[model samples]
Target: MIDLHLIGIGTGNPDHLTGEARRAITQADLILVPHKPGKSDLADLRTRIIAEVCDDALIALFDMPVRDDTLPYLTRVDAWHDEIARIWAATMAAHPEAQKIALLVWGDPSLYDSTLRIAARLDPAPRLHVVAGITSIQALTAAHAIPLNTLNAPVTISTGRRLRDHGWPDGCETLVVMLDADCTFQSLDGDGFDIWWGAYLGMPEQILEAGRLSDASVRIIARRAEARAAHGWIMDTYLLRRRA
Candidate 1:
């Protein structure tokens, strides 16, 4: 039986790893790092994180399966996840002696990540353990030096696709957007809102911009594009709130 640990490594920062994350990494028999095409930096970061906390660690570097965009969104994601599960099982089979396996997730697994869901698909399901880490939202807020919410007001976390399709969620003046490749803020009127945006948070390549949404959108778009070109990939998030 495999004891699978879903460890959150935090938003691309080795120092963001908690003591529990370190313990999990050190105890793991094998750690899996999936490298996507044109995104080698992502896999390299995971490898570096493992090396930082564990000596002579057993790591499996595998190519990530590409999602079929031609299929509908939900179906595409479901099938893609299934393919990942198959790969994980095969990888484990190759390392029969490794009963304690770990996956280094980006940010907290409970927040907008699919590692847990994919893990669940393993045959004869393995025992699961979770190690929480700092999230991108926290990184963004800390980078901007702003409170997540004003007073007792609530904050809503959403994806860029949702924000673009549905506009702002009802009853939420403060919205944090993730997984947006295109700057969807341009779709918003942005009259009374302020935006705090950060890219590659907690890393040396980190960039932060905060101002009225109307004024900041242009700068954000330009900078985000330039950074993406420079690094070949970017993970960013933004918090938008109506100015009180």
Candidate 2:
């Protein structure tokens, strides 16, 4: 059985790696990295992490398959996960002697990441171990120098899809949004709201914007578009708070 380690590397920054994450990488018999065609930089970042932390470790690379968009949402995701699991299995099979494998995850694996769910589908599933690292929300709040919660008020954490489908969550003074590809904040009324946004957090190319929602919404949308175009990919998260 494989001893799988899902180590959170925290937004592609070396400083974000913990001692536990370093140990997991060094101790692993194999490290698998996923590559996307146009997003080679992401794969490069993981490679760089390995080079810096564990240069002597054996590395394997696999191409990540794109999800089929034609199917219904949940169905599409389930099928995609199955495909990823298959790819993972095939990769692991190639190194039959390697009993310990590690995959570096961006941010904490438990938050807005599907790695854990995909691992569950592995046949003769590996023994799972998770090493937590700083989440994008933590990076966002830290970059903005703001408190995530306001004086005992509850904070609602959600994805951009939910923010678009359900509008602002009820009973929460602060909302932290993640995995927002569409800049969903533009869909909401911007009055009396403050937004703290960050893109490519913890990386050298990191960008941050914050101000009244009314003032920052359009700028964030334009900036995000330009950045995505330039880099061919982008990962961003933000915090929105309603004025008292």
Candidate 3:
């Protein structure tokens, strides 16, 4: 039986690794790193973290499969995850002696990450352990120097697709959006709404923008496009507040 540790590394920053996460990495017998063809920066960051923290731990790199866009969303994701599980099984098989294996996840594994689900598919399913790390929401809020919720008020957390489809949620004045590549905030009415937007939080390449939704919308769209073009990828999150 394998002892699998899913450790959160936080958003592309080695400094964000918690002491618990560091200890787990150093103690791991084998660490698996995923590589995407065009996203070398992501894999590089993980490699650097291991190099800095772990001593003489065995490292295995696996190619991550791209999800098919033609299939229905949920179906595509499920199939992609199954493929990843197969790859992971093969990797683990190669290291017959390794009992403790670790995977470094971006941000928090529990928040908007599917590593846990994928891990469940392993045959004889390894004993699972989770080490929590800083989430993008915390990084975004901290970058803007703003509190997540107003006094005694509720806050709603959602995805870009949900926001675009459902508009703003009811019963909450504050909303935090994630996994939105499309800038779904554009779908909401700008009246009385303020936005705090951040990209690459906790990293040297971080960027921040905030103002009335009406005033910032266009600028944010342009900036996001430019940044994505320059970096070949972008991960961002934003908080929106409706003024009372």
Candidate 4:
């Protein structure tokens, strides 16, 4: 059985990598890197991170499988995940002597990431160890220098799709949204909340905006658009607190 290490490398900044993450990389016999057609930069970022910890690391790069857009979202994602697991299994099978294979996950794998889910599809599931790294929420809160919740109130985390489909979560005063490519907040009657949004949270080109949603929505929408156009892609998260 192979030993699989899913190491979270944090948002965009390499500094967000924890000591455990570094050690996991250094000890990994093979590191799997994914390459997407338009996202060469992401692959490069992972390569750079691996280089920092293990200059001589054995890195195997694989082209990422594209999800079928024609199929329903959930079904498409499921099939796509199956393809990825197959590729990962095939890749590891090639370097059978490697024994310990590591994949650098962005942010904590336990969060909204699908690495853990994909891993479950592997045949004879490998011994999995998760190395936690800074999450976008943590980075967003840190960049804004604000507490995540108000006065011990509970915090709710959801995706942009959920927020857009279901409206605000019931009984949630503070909400954090992730994986939202569209400015779904624009669809909300945002007058009663304050938003703290950040893109590229720990990176040098990071952008942050915070204010009452009524005022900041437009600004964030424009800024996010500009950043995405400039960088070709953007990973961001935001926290919204209902104004009391």
How far is each candidate from the true structure, as Cα RMSD in Å? 0.8, 0.7, 1.0, 0.8
lDDT of 3 by residue, 1-244 (tens): 8999999999988899999999999999999999998888988888999999975878999999999999999999999999999999999999999999999999999999999999999998999999999999999998999999999888898899888887888876999999999988888878779999999899899988999999998989999999899888899999999977
Give model 2's clash tally: 0
lDDT of 2 by residue, 1-244 (tens): 7899999999878999999999999999999999998999999999999999988999999999999999998999999999999999999999999999999999999999999999999999899999998999999999989998988678899999999998888777899999889889988778879999999999999999999999999899899999999999999999999876
* Per-residue lDDT over 36-115 for candidate 4, one digit per residue giving the tens place of the 0 to 100 score: 98889999989998898889999999999999999998999999999999999999999989999999999899999999
Q: Which residue pairs clash within candidate 2?
A: none
Tell me each candidate's TM-score.
Answer: 0.98, 0.98, 0.97, 0.98
lDDT, residue 191, candidate 3: 72
Runs with alpha carbons beyond 4 Å of true place in candidate 2: none
Pairs of residues clashing in candidate 1: none
lDDT (0-100) at residue 158 of candidate 4?
95
Q: Candidate 1 has what TM-score? A: 0.98
Poorest stretch of ten by lDDT in candidate 4: 182-191
Winning model by lDDT: 2
Model 3 C-alpha RMSD to native: 1.0
Deviation in Å, model 4, residue 193 alpha carbon: 0.9
Candidate 1: residue 92 lDDT (0-100): 91
